[model samples]
Target: MTGHDRAPGSRIDTSKPHPARMYDWWLGGKDNYPVDEEMGRKLLAIEPRIPIMARANRAFMQRATRWLAQHGITQFLDIGSGIPTEPNLHQIAQRTAPEARVVYCDNDPIVLAHAEALLRSTPEGRTAYLQADVRDPADILERARDTLDFTRPVALSLIALLHFITDEDGAYDLVDAFLQGLPTGSYLMLSHGTGQFTPKGAAEADELYKNSGITLALRDRHEVERFFHGLELVDPGVAVIDTWHPELGEPVEGQQDFQPMPGFGAVARKV
Candidate 1:
């Protein structure tokens, strides 16, 4: 179910712009191709602070993980895990709680190629990788169950990922399936792109991604909150990514002057 745990040099499509590789380019990583960089550059032209937005999104992941770990949630199931970013979800959670168990899942084979770096867990903690799509909730849950104890509460993180999933693809259904599979007290954490702040820029970016064969399903604040339905949302419910729990982590610089990077982030308990 892991990248290294699979056949070597397996299915990797370099033709299209995948979420993982494009995300890598956004994070200034060298794992992406020229196509990804081209698209990323286009996005940057529209939103100059894209790298800052990426960092803010990543910081949100870390803070949310830390909050969950501090609240007694030691297991994590992170879907749509992009290219191996430093201080990944596992690192943040395990750092706070040494015994944290993390399961990283992504549909991209390129991410699988670098899954080893993600697997480097603390001796007291555990980490595993799964090559799967977020749409396949049953398979992810089944595979993650091998490494995580579903009987206990888990922190499900979909950071900067759900935007790639369009409504036609049942984004809400996928979330519900995963939440339904988890026990009570489990948590659902997510940061998604939105168009509320800059509609024109968001539209341009969406068109660019569409031409590149990628889906950019940016949702509004209200729509993003739909994913947390039936769950008890934590404080600062469904705010811009940088605004949510800014006290818990370092704030993204120059964020105050910008046009409010259009995105929504929140963490909710599955009661």
Candidate 2:
């Protein structure tokens, strides 16, 4: 809610590319505009493995969800949840725990337009969508409480999200604030795009996004690790996205040929 919900069929800006739409395009979804495809193709030229990386990021989310669910964690707060794709977080979590409660937050209007797909939940479980941004964690936590219980252990996921928020934008502070609302035993699952493997490609991609009026703040492994400062990193700490718990899910094709997918992922518990 948070008064960010738009009326059905609200105007969607097609003049430029949006991160959500571009991501949807990369995922081969049909919810994006032509401009998004144009930008996606341009990025693909810079990094041919982007689509594979996108799938790898999604697999990381699912694997982390399964891990949390297997550990008896049922509640989830997923921020910067992009356009809905198959086997969403709730679907992956609720498969193990039927009564899992999930709250998804996103600021993209197009996501709100298709949030109905995200609202579908198992009869025993619950799902809610909040049209909000990660910058305003207070409003997100307040609205998310309608479905998620902060007093209990909740898995907080920020997959492929923080890179859009720079340190100057208080990315670290916002993450700390969100974690502060959860109690002990809660988990933080995050995956961020990094420039470690391909610094020149990253710079070109960042500049391309900047020219398109989008912010792409790719970080290194050490910078990404900073987000999980006080938490206990799970086994294989801060490894490449696809390398973390590959057994929990199927491997993304063409991933083996790429150079570590140019991203990092890890899950940690707030003990």
- C-alpha TM-score for every candidate: 0.96, 0.96
lDDT tens digits by residue: candidate 2, 178-227: 99988999999999999999999999999999999888899999999999
Best by lDDT: 2
lDDT of 1 by residue, 1-271 (tens): 2222564557888777777787788888999988788878888899888888888888889888888898999999998888998988888998889888899988788888888989988888889998877888998899888889998999899998888889999999999999999999999999999888888988999999898888899999889999999999999889888888887788777777655767889999998
List of clashing residue pairs for candidate 2: none
- Colliding pairs, model 1: none
Which residues of candidate 2, in runs, are more than 4 Å off? Answer: 1-10
Please give the lDDT score for candidate 2: 0.89
